[model samples]
Target: MRDLPARLRELLLETGYTLDGVRERLGTVAATALAREETTPALRATRDGDPLGTLIRLWWLGAPVEAPDWLPVDPLVEAGLLAVQDGLVSAKVHLQPWETGGYVVSDRKVRPGDPALREDHVVGAGGASANLAQLVSRRPAGRVLDLGTGCGVQVLHLAERAREIVATDVNRRALRMARLSWALSGIDGVDARQGSLFEPVEGERFDLVVSNPPFVISPRGRFTYRESGFEADGFCHDLVRLAPRFLSQGGTCQLLANWLHVEGEDWRDRVGGWLAGTGCDGWVVQRDVQDPAEYAELWLRDAAEQGTPRYRELYDDWLGWFEAMKVTGIGFGWITLHDSGSLDPVVRVEELGQRVELPVGGYVDEVLASVGVAHRLSDEELLGARLVLAEGVVEERTGPPGAEDPSRIVLRQTRGLCRTARVGTVEAALAGVCDGDYPLGPLLAAIAELTDQDAVDLRVRAPEALRPLIAEGFFHISTA
Candidate 1:
């Protein structure tokens, strides 16, 4: 059993069963179909009795195939990774090739028209998992913690830069699968513990903490991987409030979470209150919102409960709970907290539904730094500080091309958040000349002289205008 993972890894890689190998063999069409949960195309593509095809049919498609001679059927079945019935072998778990050149083992996906999921079913790489992976800072760290690591997807990414890693989960089965994943990926030295969020790591601090927790706001805690057993977004709130205590100075914590939007309440403030006193700089980006009905249907389909006889019953229960709890809608997004160890922590919450760049860890690091600088610096200090337009930023003017004075001026970024800001003539002039060579005060004074405005008022209002740009990562505090 102990050597099973290494043996599987060697066999898998040798048989060309890696992520790139699988994709190449399946081709684009079959791979796309598989992503949609339609396996017929992939099955057709892998009809040949080759090693890679056999592996795909058995593990990737969850389809039983004949145990070939080269396969270690006895050892795999003995290790509980495979089952053999009348010589047709099938995987007991979904052995997926992750993008990080690793394998993630989880319970087979529950698709529509399939049986209901088990309570402790561990989930694989889904949208939320990928989102949190992209959102976490990849900077090298002394120690890292992956809280509520379902199948340990985050741990794979963290392993690249973290000297030590600790992964915790309430579901022991998940921890088991995570260990398998880490071992299969050749990632060792990870401390896997079984306990609910922060419980196993009490009195310890990590340089980075990341979670794609069971943040679904649900009426019943049926799924251990998706529900926290807490009432109405309280789990997410508690996670946020409790995060600061476990973060080392300058450490960061990030998670993908869902929050309730009750009637007559601002969702921003509702989520912002989670970070108000956490002693960390926080940033919340609400990427999407779904009303109660939509939210219920999404999760129902997620568990493959849509066509089941109890589908209506479960849906009604969820909707009834939402109504009783006054949850008009639900907002899903990313929450990031940076332990800046400051007396006045800066917390910013806003909606960002627009498309942006991926692997946003570096961008997020910049955002935290810029927001902290914008928050901590005084007006006079901001004026004296040197500034530069961030990379990929371009200025645009509208209102009949060739007109003497444009009706609108906009500064937009082509990267990171891809944020756009409308600016006045003074701001436009400042943007054109801010090359990090001069202080903002002198530039604003020059723009004031050119635009016939008071330098004092320009300097005061400029900081207010620049703060948003800085926070959005459109501007940088020049280090030059």
Candidate 2:
């Protein structure tokens, strides 16, 4: 059979086919051909090579046709070594590092036969895959498991840092593609198994397990790439419930999943309950919440683009499914679990606007650090902890153009964590004067006299604003 790059070059040169056109044609071919290998050979041999050899060579070099090579050949790719992946497939390899010592890479979107001519039908590596990959914890681990290993993108990453790695997927086609990817990338020491979730490795344990599973909460298991067969968000819940069984002592599991936001229950608590009594510490961050209409439309558009018919009908079914279940919205997020049963686990619900490049490993470190600190400090101790104000603090007061009175006051810290605090004049003045040596009482008295306010009133109001700033790391109190 002709190399995929050659076939792609031939198609582009002879037929003036763009990548999208070729992908569409290939999708049609895949639907009817049954065996891609048998069909691809005939297509390649009969095709003319207009811009052929150059394109194929470019693909092999991992350099785009238009760009000059600046870096040495990626070690894994040059060796026939790591997985030769699609452009999108390579995106997944950049996701998470197991730790400072460990790295994860995978080829979740690769097909063996014709590398260059392969279609994007399988949903190999895309935004979701890349997002999850970026979010994987980079901490080193003894064992790592890549669940739902599509083309094994996560497995590749795990292989870098793990003493041992295991990857599992339900689709045999996906497994085949993953193997090809591994060979092309020159990565080894990965155990590729076939099964669903933890079934293939019932007795095995891992220091870290990472998955970008098929968490799309669809009514039917229509698409193998994105939808799980389990009903009513059961797949996500089961993963959360079952991850603990395979985790080693102090091990962690990081996953990206979608859950239904039902009408009656708090989504946060609902997800939190899934981890109860598993002897694990969990941190779940919900990033986005889409209502049923928006959810249905998004998935419907995705399906339609993938050539699924009856878009309108499918759209209705999705809404009906959500309505029947009383699901008002769908929550999308990341869930991280640690098997070491710490008393207080880090659970944060934050609104991360739109999409931003987040340093996943850095955030994971912060979470771990916060959890460690929480365990060491009692509630009372945390509350009573005196923190010195960070240095180089500045306050800016702004007023309307002709008004004598300032409309707003903003306080910003120049160093440390760099937080901003809004304040009243009294509070701002107090903060500016705080030198760690002065007692709160004397400062308030001095401020009261200067501003013509009652000392008692000054004392009462000043602490209210000052205490929060102090606790939040904006201001620190002196130990001396």
Candidate 3:
């Protein structure tokens, strides 16, 4: 095995084979043999100068190739360093870098163990990866579960942060590849198990659970790496339903998923209903929606580009499946669940028109900040909250000259959370006097005297304006 690399090097030079070309040849050689003999072709081709002998030698090794390596092998495979992985696999690594205890890095493309499958295109680290990474609460936990551990990217990332990490997948090939990638990458202490969802981890619980499941909604399971068995929306539903049992109190489950937009049902309520009585605080952000035709075409192109034939047939099948299920469209997004069951857990639905660049080491920070703020201010407590006007906030008033002293004054925030507040004269006067020194009562008194308004009445109304301004981020209060 040690001499394998040298022989492989020689074969490449003699054949004038590029890395990708060699990988393809190796995959084809491997597919004919047993799983145990998978890497024999590349090893023999390297050892012997005769390419035919090497090919025959691979047959003796018992490994066989079935697919091409759409994934690539570059710096990762060159140094026997990191494992070669797909885009989704790479995205998991990119998303949760902190879990690795150091920065996670990978080439955009790399080769798989099989050679016949030599040329694969990987999508870039996308929004789903970023969102899952961001939703990860950084607090250290005892055990982390990376469900559907494709290429073991999530497992590698989690190994850095969690005391123990377990990665589960249903594909034996993916599991094998993940193990090789793990070894190649030099990431230690990750247990790569093969099973669907939580099957292997039955009766096991974790402090944190993260997944970028095969949530693609398809008519049939075309590709094991990308599609799940639950049919349409079943993958996400099962994940959400099953997560509560595995999560520790106050722990979190963060995932990237695709859900169907069914006819006559709002997507938000559909997902929201999945969380009812789960005792989990849920945040689901729907990033994009594609109609049936568009969705079918997108995945069809994906299949065709991956060298899958029967493009029109596959496209028709996808449409027929969606039509049968009454699925109008596909909704792609992220969902995070915290075990802490606040009476009113954070549930927000917004459309991100386009992708936003994810901040490094900023995901956990944002989650913590939102949780802290949400816990601190619940319901009526917000009414009593006192805040100072933020710096760089300016009042802009626009109206015709002598136009009843202007209809309204617009208070715009220049930093923090971008927000704008329109204020009535009384509210405007109160905000103008807040210099971060006076308490709310004292400031309201002074404003009342200046404007000739009743102090008690001013105090009561003043808080209402402050509430919206503070909440909208037009003003921020000093912690002191």
In order, what lDDT does every prediction score?
0.90, 0.62, 0.60
Off by over 4 Å in 2: 1-121, 305-309, 354-357, 371-376, 383-480
- What are the per-residue Cα lDDT tens digits for candidate 3 across 1-480? 444334433443454343344445556555444233344445555454344333223222222222124322343245343233442111212111223332222222222331222122222223455456655666677989988776666665555678988888887756655664465345667877888989999998888999988888887765666677566788889899899899887778888888888899898888887776677777676778899999877765544432345556777777888888898888887777777645656544444445443432334334433544544464345434455666668888988997878866898655433346778887677567665665667666777788788988876666555655654445555567
Model 1, residue pairs in steric clash: none
Candidate 3 whole-model C-alpha lDDT, 0 to 1:
0.60
Model 1 CA RMSD to the hidden true structure, in angstroms: 1.3
User: Each prediction's TM-score against the native?
Assistant: 0.98, 0.63, 0.64
Q: Which ten residues in a row have the lowest lDDT in candidate 2?
A: 88-97
- Summarize candidate 1's per-residue lDDT along 332-416 as a digit string, tens digits: 9999999988899999998888898988896688888888998888988889989898889999999986789999999998898
Order the candidate numbers by lDDT, best to worst. Answer: 1, 2, 3
By TM-score, the better pick of 1 and 3 is 1
For every model shown, the clashing-pair count is 0, 28, 34
After superposition, candidate 1 runs with Cα above 4 Å error: none
Worst 10 residues of 1 by lDDT: 108-117
lDDT of 2 by residue, 275-380 (tens): 7767776777787899998987777655443234465777788889889999999999888888656665544343343443355654475454444444445433
